[model samples]
Target chain A: MPIARGYAATDASKPLTPFTFERRNPNPDDVVIDIKFAGICHSDIHTVRNEWKNAVYPIVPGHEIAGIVSAVGSDVTKFKVGDRVGVGCFVDSCIGCAERDLDREQYMPGLAGTYNDFEADRKTRTQGGYSDSIVVREGYVMSIPDNLPLDASAPLLCAGITLYSPLRHWNAGPGKKVAIVGMGGLGHMGVKLGAAMGADITVLSQSLSKKEDGLKLGAKEYYATNDPETFTKLAGTFDLIICTVSAEIDWNAYLGLLKVDGSFVVVGAPENPIPVHAFSIIPGRKSISGSMIGSIKETQEMLDFCGEHNIVSEIEKINIQQVNEAYERVLKSDVRYRFVIDIASLAA
Target chain B: MPIARGYAATDASKPLTPFTFERRNPNPDDVVIDIKFAGICHSDIHTVRNEWKNAVYPIVPGHEIAGIVSAVGSDVTKFKVGDRVGVGCFVDSCIGCAERDLDREQYMPGLAGTYNDFEADRKTRTQGGYSDSIVVREGYVMSIPDNLPLDASAPLLCAGITLYSPLRHWNAGPGKKVAIVGMGGLGHMGVKLGAAMGADITVLSQSLSKKEDGLKLGAKEYYATNDPETFTKLAGTFDLIICTVSAEIDWNAYLGLLKVDGSFVVVGAPENPIPVHAFSIIPGRKSISGSMIGSIKETQEMLDFCGEHNIVSEIEKINIQQVNEAYERVLKSDVRYRFVIDIASLAA
Candidate 1:
């Protein structure tokens, strides 16, 4: 057993605080990783505050994890000591279903969250990567390319793959026009990935506040969604629109922004049901869809693509002690893009 | 100009009455069809009663037109005297746009409604096929297959293509499990078309009252949506679902019926917005999309396919005088599939 130091939300009202826990020793197929960097995802905030209503108490929430392989069990063949790796949103799913056979394991009905849920044992609760170390099955771990730095690539495990899967599924490439709604953590990755996939990228944000950053991230155009004229100007313009905002907007108005046979996809779930009109999609053969974080295989593909294109999340690295303040900044949409916690700070 | 006698709704509150109007004499590319049958669609009732809020008074409400081409202008290449033909929801659209170039003219911004809307000239409200005759450009008219009957195939012009386009676009075929979420005019066609496409079909009606009819129409399974167990038992069961109901439903419940990457499509617009939860689609990579009456090219393909499959609307034939009564029955969903008016009855 390894003694792991991490931050946990003991209850909904209190801030995350230092907690000491014990992680199981590596099993035959397990690889123990010394977690170097962990990205603070919006879901972490939701879980810590019990917003989604199913959050288990004493939750140590982090899934966008990047680390170095510290130890390997006897059956671990893919990595040895000192290898770089990452683990994303989910730790395991039912592996015998047809979806698993298709490598779309995230859709398996028995999927287990990386944190705030019981592991396959159905009794021991699974913690997350805010800790100093983690032990995961070999198949659940992904190899990070040497060219990509761990701190910046941390968010790529979650936000990066979330955007990448939809872009690839919808065929966002040459001759395609794509719009990324919101300029926060997930959306910024969409602009970069869409552009890298040869799409004409446009950013639909609440304001021009992030125009320069969006352009720098490979977006060819940016528009403020709050401006009425923006809707009129871009009506029927996009082949694919990926909405990363977790708040509900006039979904029908955004549906008008798509061309015939276009798709509007969401990566974030709003608290309330989104009101959509059938005519908005029916008139043009349009679609409104949603995607979760990528499958493990797709997540690995996203990392490799990012490495090939020199793409990594725009991150604001902070010490583990600054996590509470970082969460506040995140709620205010004040972070530049993403916040990466330096796990070494947890040890001190 | 040619004088045409038909029934027209003079206002939202009144019954349709006898009216006489003039249709333009053939232009160089025109074909004048003497309407032999007109299917009374729910939309015809909606437009006549100003339900969609865009109806113009004195509207002749019919779009599912089947007729004999009686006249053709000098340059009319597609239709000649006595040719069997059909007309659908729209008469014309902005013909030079990229959408038109792609044969998706129905999505053009300047699309002209078959009735209660101005033509391409932007004035002179176009009367619908409820009239004795209609003059349209040759390109806008589709040739009815020789083996199909004029009365039963009339609804195929609109309802048939509406379902066919989405099923084909979503790739519903062998090995796919499809569900049609109503058993009315459009839904019956969906079951027939989806099954004929080699997909296994299920009917998710509000009651098992239609179970026998659904099975008779080639559905392999029929479930009553009113049963709570139906939702639970069929969860994650379908690859594609086409919703033809125009009433608001708890759409998230139906989204649960889809498999990973499945589609839930709507062809009818409810007056109120459809509330959708992002989690419903995001967890499974599912989609909520809509399809209108298809492109002219696709409509022709649908008619040809229906011909090959021996498919046509299950129509209840009536005289012109029975139209008002039919409208009331349509409102109650009491018609056995569709209602087609025998045009010769108008001569009295």
Candidate 2:
């Protein structure tokens, strides 16, 4: 067993505090990573506060992890000591792996989550990426591009891939008119990746507050969705609308902007059910859909695409001690984009 | 003006009665068809009863018509007086007379429906195929293949194209598992077309009453949605589900059957709104979409494919006088598949 340190919330309402933990020795296909950076995902906040009712406390919540490989078991072919690697929302999946068929192995009856989920033995609790070190299967760990800085690449495991998966799956490319709703962590990445994929990108935000930032991220157009004229002007315009905001927008208003057979892909999963009118999808033969993060193969593709395109999140690096304050700022939509933690501060 | 004979529903609740009307004189780009057979679509029922609330009565409700061209304008190069031409759904679209992105054009804001809709001028209300003669622009008229008899090809216009559009759009082919919901006019066609497209087909009906016919139409599996075990045995099994039934099914239950990012395309639209939990779509990355009839290009493609495949809807051919009884039978789900009206019966 290896002693490790991380910031954890012992109770739902409490701020994170320094906690000690243990990591099991690496198996033949496992690699031990010394965590350098961890991204503060919205899901971490939700789980830490028990907002989603699945938080098991003394929870060290972080899934977007980037680090240096410190050790590898004999059979670990993908990584060697000193290599940079990253872990995303999941750590271990079904043994069958059942490569890349939506609900087949991982998320269906035979899946595992990064934190608060039982390991393959169904007895060991799987600790997440916020810790100083983690032992993960080599197949679950990805090679982080050398050109991409570790801190900047942390959120790619979550925010970057969440947007990338849908855009790629929906065929966003040259001549495709794509819209990204909201301009926060996920939205900004959507704009950047969409542009990188050669799509004509548009940003639809609450006000024009993020208009300048949107254009800087390669958006061809920006509009305030709050304006009534926005709906009128953009009616039947977008071929695909990727919504990344967690809160509910007026869905009918969004549905009105879809062209014939257009899709509204929801990455913004709110706790409440979305009250959707069937009529919204009827007239123009539109679609309402939702997408989760990418598969292991797709994540690699996203990483390669990012490496080639020089794309990374506009991250605000914070010390481990500022995590609680950062959470409040994140809730208020005050962060520039993502807040990544410098994991060394956990030792202090 | 050419004095034409047809059937019109004078009021919302009354059965359609024999009536006399006038079609416009053939324009330079027009072809006049001597209507032979008209297939009854669910939309025809909706229009005659004003159930969609947008229907204009004394409406002539028909869009699937197969006939011989009786007259052609001097500049109409596509069709001659004796050619077999068929008219379906929308006869005129905003991006008129062009096949480039015709699906986009079909639902364009100002696109006109074949019947019970105001024409391009916004003054003349266009009648439809349930008549003795129809003068249509050459662009909207398709050539029916010689192998597919006119009686059988009538339903091919509406029912055939509706299923073909979604099946092809969703990539239903060899190695793909496709499910057709319901066994009515559209559903039967879906099964035959999906099977002919080289996909493994399944039928989800209310009961096993249509099981034999479903198998004969190319279904590899037949299950009743009402049976509790149907979901358990086939959960996460299908790649594409073309929902031909308009009434709401258990969305999450059906969603559970999709194999990650799989699509359920709704061809039959229900009147009421469906309550969908965002979590249903989010977790599996599944989609629920609606499709209207196909474009003229795809309709021709569908007819050609049907002609080569020797595919047609199982129909009960009736004189125009039996349309009232046919509607009652359709409402009861008594018709085997579709009802085709012999237009010459109107002159009796």
Model 1 Cα lDDT, one tens digit per residue, A1-348: 788999999999999999999888779989999999999999999999998899788999999999999999999999999999999988878877788888889877788788998777777788998999988888899999999999999999999999999999999999899999999999999989999999999999999999999999999999998899999999989999999998868888999999999999999889898888878887888899988888888999999999899999999999999999999999999998999999999867
Q: Write the per-residue lDDT of candidate 1 for residues B1-348, one digit (tens) a residue.
A: 899999999999999999999997678888999999999988888888898898778999899999999999999888889999999988888888888889888877898888999887998789998889999888889999999999999999999998999899889899999999999999999999999999999999999988899999999999999899999999999999999998877789999999999999988888888888888989899999888888889999999999999999999999998899999999899988999999999988
lDDT of 2 by residue, B1-348 (tens): 898888999889899998789888789989999999999998899888988788777788899899999888889998898998799988777664333455555556676788998766788888987899988889889999888889889999999999998899889999999999898999999999999999999999999999999999999999999998999999888999988887877877887888877887777877666666777888778888877788788899999999899998899999999999999999899998999999988878
lDDT of 2 by residue, A84-124 (tens): 99999887776654543442333455556778777767777
lDDT of each: 0.92, 0.87
In model 2, which runs have C-alpha deviations exceeding 4 angstroms? A95-97, A100-109, A275-279, A282-285, B95-104
Q: How well is candidate 1 docked (DockQ)?
A: 0.88
Candidate 1, residue A129: how far the Cα is off, in Å: 0.9
Model 2 per-residue lDDT at B70? 89
Q: Candidate 2: what lDDT?
A: 0.87
Native contacts recovered, each model:
0.94, 0.73
Top DockQ model: 1
Reference-based TM-score of each model: 0.98, 0.94
TM-score of 1: 0.98
Best by lDDT: 1
